[model samples]
Target: MNKAQEKPIALSIRNLVKTYGKVAAIDNVSLDIASGEFLSLLGPSGSGKSTILMAIAGFVTPDSGEILLNGQKIDALSPEKRQFGVVFQGYALFPHMSVRGNIAYPLKLRGIKGAELDAQVERTIDLVHLSALADRMPRQLSGGQQQRVALARALVFDPSVVLLDEPLSALDKKLRAELQFELRSLHQRLGTTFVNVTHDQEEAMTMSDRIVILRDGAVQQIGAPDSLYNRPSTRFVADFLGRANFLEGAVSSVNGTELKIDVKGIAVRHAKGKDAAAQGEKTLLALRPERIAVVSPDQAKTSLNRIDGSVQTSAFVGSQYVYVIDTPLGTIESQMPAFEAGPLRQPGAQVAVTWSPEAGVLVKDK
Candidate 1:
């Protein structure tokens, strides 16, 4: 079992349901967040990611279901009583107060004063590497610095959990990437159960120990980043987590653990693991672009699956070259590492795409 599974449950949502007017914003969703695990609620806008986060923070009351903390239900508790630190998307830093004051506010609210509050504020500030900027106001600090202040404030009280709602969404790409690493490191050092909400797939995959994917106010899938990315249970997951090329076909033959799918008369070999499709059953294969290799038609075909196609379009994307290949089945997208992609394949160039049977994962059509 993974470390997360070994840890005790810090929070649990049992059959959580929340509705807005006639729409169910969070539809019968349930999840267990292990102590010290960094779990991200990931999905597009209006997918209920934020709604679930708000519910956990006690900001939004659910119509049904229970929110538990350390095995005890806290559904009736107010936001502050739950002792779950929250970092809003806007940072919500106190413009009138200095960083030290902002960090000390939570402690002050609890009647903590004097050396105790000062020490806690100082320790939390240093924890987020903001000791030097303790006296700076929110307006005087950079976006990243302001975010650190917000985090320090949330953590000062030593809350049972920290809830982040797209905390890094306001920063630029480079700064955001830098903070993502820092935030992950902070989580490791503190071992605090962090429940984050985000729409950015890369951000979710980068910082999460495990991710809960939601869609249309309901849970879609929940698993470790690599597990969900490599062996997605559905087409939605396969496409949402990363770029995926789908091949629709019917199983033509089954040989022990291996199965062959007939895609427009082309035999696409697939490995049937636990969830196997029966022979003649319609199947959908989610193939990652990076798994496909574009080679000359005369190149030796050692892989189980190969298809002849012409490069429809090609573009250099920093570390990799992305190509759109037009094949009999459909337009297949392939991403080849710049180091391995010897020369750019021009449009209309004939090529053969190859991938191993193990590379294609069978996913539900839905």
Candidate 2:
């Protein structure tokens, strides 16, 4: 299998509470991290993600809570006893130490010397593909190479878990993507629990097995990436995970599982997921830009939810052309594939946007 599976849970945090002066950095946070699972804590700045990571690493003591490692309480244990490897944004490599010495630091501290230290260091260096630069110092290596060194050092000690705090934020976009692949590959090969904290949605979605969304120092929602993206529990998650266009409406009626709502002067239909909206309740329909289709008015299908609008602007953004349409429901954004051979609509050109009822995400107005 490509993924690490069938292992037991590795860590559990119950009722974790922490405060800084009058601010609650983390409030009643509880999460279970599975063994060999890659989970990410995603949020905006000050959403308490880094605070949660620090609490897990035992670097920042919480006001109250119990942290359990493999069912044993570890709140009173120090960071060294936790045996969790940590890699931060800056890499934090020892500038005076060579790559081999850097990777061997933790082992050497435990009195592992001679051929054993060499074997361990060489093994980790091979894991990170740094054999060519094993003799280079931190200042002599590039940003990506230094990141690999940090990763190698973290893994060389064979820690029970690894906590990464914006580990790839220092690298450029292309290099970050490359490192993301290497990180995931390492996880699969080693089968170690990895907890990552980041504000970047794409990075979390790309590398994590599950994502926990946080807002204002509390849990907003937690689930698989696609589940959270397609069926967000609230407006914040739908907007933050990706670009979404909101169409406000009041619930007119609910027929069994389907919902009929009134948007502006038009009646729109949407399918409910898990929760149904009450009649007369204000709700917002969150539709993704790429989920919309722009077609000629004559060719619009009857089964699709169709809206006629004038194209306000169209801009080519790499692989897709984003079009802003001025419809009765205010402004809506639609993305069409850039390489597709079709008639390009100009500003002021009349067009129709169509999408299935399944594509409409019904989110509470709050």
How do all models score by TM-score? 0.98, 0.95
lDDT of each: 0.93, 0.89
Off by over 4 Å in 2: 1-6, 273-275, 301-303, 341-343
How many clashes show up in model 2? 0
**What's every prediction's RMSD, in angstroms?**
1.0, 2.1
lDDT of 2 by residue, 132-156 (tens): 9999989999999999999898889
Q: Model 2: C-alpha RMSD to truth?
A: 2.1
**Of the candidates shown, which would achieve the greatest lDDT relative to the real structure?**
1
